[model samples]
Target: MSGVFQRISSIWREFCKRRAYGALIHPDGIAAQAEELARLADLALRSTAALSALECRHLAQLAQSMRQLRETAHSPEFCRLSADRRLALHRQLLTAREKLLASLQKTQISTEKLQ
Candidate 1:
């Protein structure tokens, strides 16, 4: 083989090797994001069932993480799932965020009315 052909073959072999081992590499960022999303999901659930101050704190944190999650979803590395699942998750997060905000607003209005 000529010099260019030799270099091309060597590069192709290296790429294949990396692909074979890529899954074994730690995907810490993906894991971290999944953990965060799981936390937010739990908080969203808690908020729906309880109206205590702690639930409010969790909801606030979830809202902030959700904004970050939305940003992460837009990244090039993120893959879009089926349309149905994507829309479902989006609706869940948005509904939770809005619900929390509306409840807070109502509480504020009631407090103002009493004062």
Candidate 2:
């Protein structure tokens, strides 16, 4: 039937997209990792401790990856997701932002004790 063919086509297209854009496909996991990285960055900035050379290099690498994610968000490939998936990504981003903000407060509290 034509309907069955269309469903199969859709599935194939989605699979291809997922393969091609693996980073953007799992927005929930990506958002969580981003939030955690941001929290660590915040802690580093707030703490009196100095960062080792390796830690600085790692943060530089993370900055480049974050920039790639920003660029990908503007690409047509990022728009290929279904509306529900896009909405879920948006919601996850918002949740991640809130968590990052909460983490900043905790980091501040702990760092203040060290000062």
Candidate 3:
């Protein structure tokens, strides 16, 4: 009976250790991810050949949002965020990427229009 109990306890401890390790997010990782997103947004803005007034405005807004996100990720407060909050921030980043892509797709000007 004692041996069985010890084995179960050891397994449970290992599982808990793995779970805790998986939950941690290094601050630098978050900062790097945010920077990459910002870079992509900036590249999209510069690479687009012809953006209408509305598209320009939308792109500007997206760029601002990306800047804010990057700033937030680098802040000390961000480092203190709970694991769940960090996860939520990661989800928000994904959503931001999708929005950026959608905005780019919508603003694509046909070559025929340019000519």
For each candidate in turn, the TM-score is 0.39, 0.43, 0.59
Candidate numbers, best lDDT first, in rank order: 3, 2, 1
lDDT of 3: 0.69
Worst 10 residues of 2 by lDDT: 106-115
C-alpha root-mean-square deviation, each candidate: 12.5, 8.2, 7.0
- Candidate 2: where are CA atoms >4 Å away? 1-65, 109-115
Q: Is candidate 1 or candidate 2 better by lDDT?
A: 2
lDDT of 3 by residue, 1-115 (tens): 9999999987787556446744335566566667777787777778786776776677677677767766776688876666666666667777877887787687653454544
Candidates' lDDT values, in order? 0.53, 0.58, 0.69
Write one digit per residue (lDDT tens) for candidate 2, span 23-109. 644654454555555555545544524555775565556545554555565567766666457556656656755654564455434
Q: Which one is best on TM-score?
A: 3
lDDT of 2 at 93: 55
Number of the top candidate by lDDT?
Answer: 3
Task: Report the Cα lDDT for residue 2, model 3.
Answer: 100
Off by more than 4 A, model 1: 1-53, 109-115
Worst 10 residues of 1 by lDDT: 22-31
* Number of clashing pairs per prediction, in order: 0, 0, 0
What is the overall TM-score of model 2 with all chains considered together? 0.43
Query: 1-115, model 1: which lDDT tens digit per residue?
Result: 5999999987787566446544322233333444455565555554353357776677666756755765666465544333333445555655664665566554422222444
